[model samples]
Target: MAKGKEVRLTIVLECTTCVRNGGNVNKASTGISRYITQKNRHNTPNRLELRKFCPYCYKHTIHGEIKK
Candidate 1:
């Protein structure tokens, strides 16, 4: 069985550009690109965001934390 809570947590980061441009019906989203990383729950309780490369966007964009 797992403990009540965990210190280090695994999270998913999704491209914000992909989400904002989701209305385009012609080009089907390659699906929002995601990056998996770990964070210390006690240190940073807020959602994390990072600039990362989005292949679909063809540029670096803000990737925000999303629920798994």
Candidate 2:
């Protein structure tokens, strides 16, 4: 017998604004924010984009899926 493929997949999300400015590697008032989450491969085939709070940015911004 065979088993089905994985339905849930883990993904990484990063702040768009911070990345645009450049990689804020230093620990200061600003830096790139990343989040770890899971998604259903079948339900949403496209990349996931979510609105989340960026502590570094001091506001909410769009967090797009990034490669591992």
* Per-residue lDDT of candidate 1, residues 1-68 (tens digit): 47648899999998888888783422754667789999999999999999999877778989999999
For residues 1-68, write the lDDT of model 2, one tens digit per residue.
Answer: 33448888999999998899885634677568999999999999999999999888888999999999
Model 2 residue 33 distance off true place after TM-score fit, in angstroms: 0.1
The segments of candidate 1 whose C-alpha lies over 4 angstroms from its true place after superposition are 23-29
TM-score of structure candidate 2: 0.83
TM-score each candidate: 0.82, 0.83
For model 2, what is the error of residue 36's alpha carbon versus the real structure, in angstroms, after optimal superposition? 0.3
Q: Report lDDT (CA) for all predictions.
A: 0.84, 0.88
Local distance difference test, candidate 1? 0.84
